[model samples]
Target chain A: DVKVTQSSRYLVKRTGEKVFLECVQDMDHENMFWYRQDPGLGLRLIYFSYDVKMKEKGDIPEGYSVSREKKERFSLILESASTNQTSMYLCATTAGPYNEQFFGPGTRLTVL
Target chain B: AQSVTQPDIHITVSEGASLELRCNYSYGATPYLFWYVQSPGQGLQLLLKYFSGDTLVQGIKGFEAEFKRSQSSFNLRKPSVHWSDAAEYFCASGYFGNEKLTFGTGTRLTIIP
Candidate 1:
């Protein structure tokens, strides 16, 4: 089965702390995405990487950054955590457009 | 810009009752529509998708959805609901194949036995 693995399932951080959430996929898919799931907001795109070292800002990329140093690994970085940034972050990978994405279990972040 | 709308924020139904979840979308071209279900604390799972061919599409877990081009709607339905079917259902649409998906606010379903 294809799996998108997230390194952390939960994390707690203080304001102004840098936090990293890692994701890896075994499918060799060319596209990887980061989204934050919130109540009444659904899942909003934060960042996505098409290929190694190539990234694009999504609708809510203001407080987030991404790293795609390897083909199978993608990382979402929080420059400085804030209370408003607390949410469930999901990572997904897919081969091409409009196709099914394999998503990781998600990481629930709490900022104090 | 392409967008999707799911008006119902929460829905409740009995285990043996029929179910229908509405979804609406706006896009310039022929859009790619999809339904995904997410259990509590879990990742989203694809329930069905419409890429063309037939307007009515069947999916796993006995869920089905019909696409109506005139109304720009893709509504999901099930003949009978099960207790385990309670979850958050999301409807999404995008113009590009294999590209980023723009999802709706999502509708949470609750099954009462």
Candidate 2:
């Protein structure tokens, strides 16, 4: 079975503070993704990484960035957090395109 | 651009009752269809996927989905609903070999015991 783990299940941060959400996968997948889920809006992609040091912006990439220094780890960074940034962040990894994706539990971020 | 739509926002069903969730997609070519379930405060889990060959696909947790090319629909069905089946279900579509998937708003299911 594939396992995807997030660094934190919940987090709280003040406005203008920096926030980092980490995700790690044990399946050695080549594609990793970050998404924010909201009620009535579903899951919106924030960023995705196809390979180490290669990142692509998703539909809603504003106010967020990503880092993929290694194959197993992908990190989402909020340079300066704001209240509007509060959301349930999810991380997913897939071994190849057109394959099933494994997701982490998710990190619920609260930006006050 | 490909898109997915899940018409029902919320559904209520009694235990042991039949269940069906509707999903439709808009894409130029043959799209990759998937159904995912997410428990409260949890990440999304793949229930099933429809790429090719078999239009009807079976998934875990006693769930199944059928793809209709004529209607551009991939509806999920379950013979018997259980209380534990309550969760948010999403329909997603993607292009072949695409890295991103377009997801629907999701339907929240409530199972009555």
lDDT of 2 by residue, A81-104 (tens): 999999999999985768567889
Between which residue pairs do clashes occur in model 2?
none
lDDT of each: 0.93, 0.93
In candidate 1, position A52 carries an lDDT of: 99
Error of 1 at B72 (Å): 0.4
What 10-residue stretch in candidate 1 chain A is worst by lDDT?
A94-103
Please, what are the lDDT tens digits per residue for candidate 1 over residues A45-105?
9998889999999999998899999999999999999999999999998756666677899
Interface root mean square deviation per prediction: 1.7, 1.2
Give the winner by DockQ: 2
Q: List the candidate 2 regions with Cα displacement exceeding 4 Å.
A: none
lDDT digits (tens) for residues B1-113 of candidate 2: 77888999999999999999999999979988889999998899999998889899999999999999999999999999999999999999887688788899999999988
Name the weakest run of 10 consecutive residues (lDDT summed) in model 2 chain B: B93-102
- Candidate 1, residue B103: CA error in Å? 0.2
Model 1 regions more than 4 Å off:
none
